[model samples]
Target: MVIVLSAGKLILTPTELLCRLSSGATLRALPDDIRLVTTPPLLIADAGAVSWTLPLDGVECLDDITEFYGFAKE
Candidate 1:
């Protein structure tokens, strides 16, 4: 699980190891030559940094993110 700041709030979201391999909206060190499957289209900057908003709420737990990504802790 990874905590990301989105829309001014800290949201706990599932982090997939493979996601790191895919190219993001931000031109970070991600692999750009390959296509991705079943992944959320990320908003990235040219610098390879992810573009996210911090939510108004405080830090969230992984359980709270299940609805968004259908993730379940193993």
Candidate 2:
């Protein structure tokens, strides 16, 4: 499981192990370490096993996120 936060109109995706967030900025975190802090118009993520809020524009329940990646293989 991975947590994604949309930065403005931009969506950050990981290629293999690297996740690029912005120009010349990147972050690395294991999926299990991810936690969400929900607030209106912004969702905060706490990863890297540390207590911090990585602010995001939106949040979603785990179930709904499946389609965002792609349909499951048969």
Candidate 3:
């Protein structure tokens, strides 16, 4: 999935710690309702809606820098 960020770019993975953070999406503690079992590529809409094609089965938390791609971080 690919989410369009405010920076006018696309966030390919919603579960990526870096992508989520860079996109300005707050990452709170894991909620009982939500479980991060797997870190799959996610696509979020500019409106903040999240969607993923793969199953999230074993994901825990996102890191500060998940993976650097495309543009360099300032």
Which is the leading candidate under TM-score?
A: 2
lDDT of 1 by residue, 1-74 (tens): 43343432222234321222222332222222222122232222132344322122332433344444563333
Q: Model 1 compared with the native: what TM-score? A: 0.21
Q: What would the per-residue lDDT of candidate 2 be over residues 4-70, giving only the tens digit for each residue?
A: 4453222324322234465556654443334433444332334535433345544453222223333
Better of 1 and 2 by lDDT: 2
Model 3 global lDDT (CA atoms, 0 to 1): 0.30
Candidate 1 backbone clash number: 16
TM-score: which is higher, 2 or 3?
A: 2
Q: State how far residue 10 of model 2 sits from its true place (Å).
A: 8.8
Off by over 4 Å in 2: 1-18, 40-52, 60-74
Clashes of 2: 0
